[model samples]
Target: MDFATPRRRRPAEAIVPMINVVFLLLIFFLMSAQITPPAPFDVTLPESENDNAARPADTLYMDAQGQLAFNTARGEAVYDAIAARAAPDTPLQIRADARLEAQALARFLPELAARGIAEIELLTGMP
Candidate 1:
């Protein structure tokens, strides 16, 4: 009787190392990501045909009740904060609630101009 040679088995790939690498990548992305702060109040933006995407920089918020907020500043204090932060030429973005009056916005513009905000962009949502 001839002696049979023992069969050799190949080792399986190490899934544990792959899993560790994936976890490390997830951790890195979570740490490196920039998280945007929530808006101070809810705003229902007006619908428009415009498809423009707004930059997150230099934004002012106005609610349906005509209350204004800019960063940590609120109410009339927001004007002072905006004046301090805005340059004469840089356009400020206004995120106004849909329910806010056009007349109110008209009045608000002069206040901004008095504070030296010469230009502004009104943000709107797709209909």
Candidate 2:
């Protein structure tokens, strides 16, 4: 009887199910991520078709009672706090109620201007 060498068997291919699962998980996370807006106050900003630019770095708000509020803080002394917190170069966004008096706004604007605030934007409701 003649003796012959045994045939060598090739190893099986690696499983790809784990790779597919990882890819699916990545896609799920990407889709479920939340993108939040960068406003400190809950004021309903009036929208404009011409406003496709990014939001300003700082915000000031005047409520119905002619009271001023800054960012996330609530008080009448917000002007000084806002001036302290804002950068010298960043523009300030002002949101005032429709019924607010012009005299009150006039009184506070100069104070902001004196504090090295350059650009001031008045937010108005959409007509």
Candidate 3:
């Protein structure tokens, strides 16, 4: 003739195992993820100590002689070609030689800006 109330049972799930799994996944991603540098055309670029900057795919190159190139093609032809292919919002990267004067950049940037390209990045390598 007993009439005592039944006891409640707690959930058997443990957060420790879940936390361990999360940590393992984090470590796996950290180890598996690879970082690769962007390959622009062959050009001698300016050197800098900062190497953690992100690069854009669309690059404009200026050689030591102040000759311009987009990718591999040289001179104004490449500039026109790039202008035709690139969108207004294309991220433009400039890889100019250290000896290349600022006047070269100044001349082209205005036209690039006029074409609705506002985002410009200067490429530099680790010294």
Candidate 4:
């Protein structure tokens, strides 16, 4: 006659603990991730002596090639598009090339001002 005792059955509760841990980790990562707005182009901004304040959420760019873009989207007239999207309360940041002509910069200022974009922020790299 066999004298071996009947094998005890293990509880099926292990899966429940693993599932809970996985869900907790997923929630943590989602909360920590940051979402940023896209840019129209890739241009190296000129550095400034004073680099105060953080970068703005809304940015408009003008590259050295005289191309106008918004939030990394090229082939668009920046002034009109930015004016349309901008409101008096929300300021628009301009990241223009240092080598860009003064006349060109001068021309756009009035357009931006006329649209009630009072708070203008210029972005520059760290010197």
TM-score of each: 0.81, 0.57, 0.58, 0.65
TM accuracy, model 1: 0.81
lDDT value for model 2: 0.70
- In terms of lDDT, the poorest run of 10 residues in model 1 is 7-16
The C-alpha RMSD of each candidate to the native structure, in angstroms, is 4.2, 7.2, 8.3, 4.9
What's the CA error at residue 125 for candidate 2, in Å?
A: 3.0
| Cα RMSD for predicted model 4 | 4.9
Worst 10 residues of 2 by lDDT: 36-45
Clashes of each: 0, 0, 0, 6
Question: Which prediction has more favorable TM-score, 2 or 3?
Answer: 3
1-127: candidate 4 lDDT, tens digit per residue: 9999997656666578889999999999999888776555567778778858665456778777666777545554666577667454777887888777868877778877876788878788887
Candidate 4 residue pairs in backbone clash: 39-71, 39-72, 40-71, 40-72, 40-73, 41-72
Top of the candidates by lDDT? 1
Please, what are the lDDT tens digits per residue for candidate 1 over residues 11-99? 54456778889999999999999788789999999999979898767789999999999889999899889988945467899999999
Which 10-residue window of candidate 3 scores lowest in summed lDDT?
A: 35-44
Off by over 4 Å in 3: 1-42, 86-88
Residues 82-103, candidate 3, lDDT per residue (tens digit)?
Answer: 7676454667878888888888
Evaluated at residue 98, the lDDT of candidate 2 is 62
Candidate 2 regions off by >4 Å?
A: 1-54
> On a 0 to 100 scale, what is the lDDT of residue 114 in model 2?
79
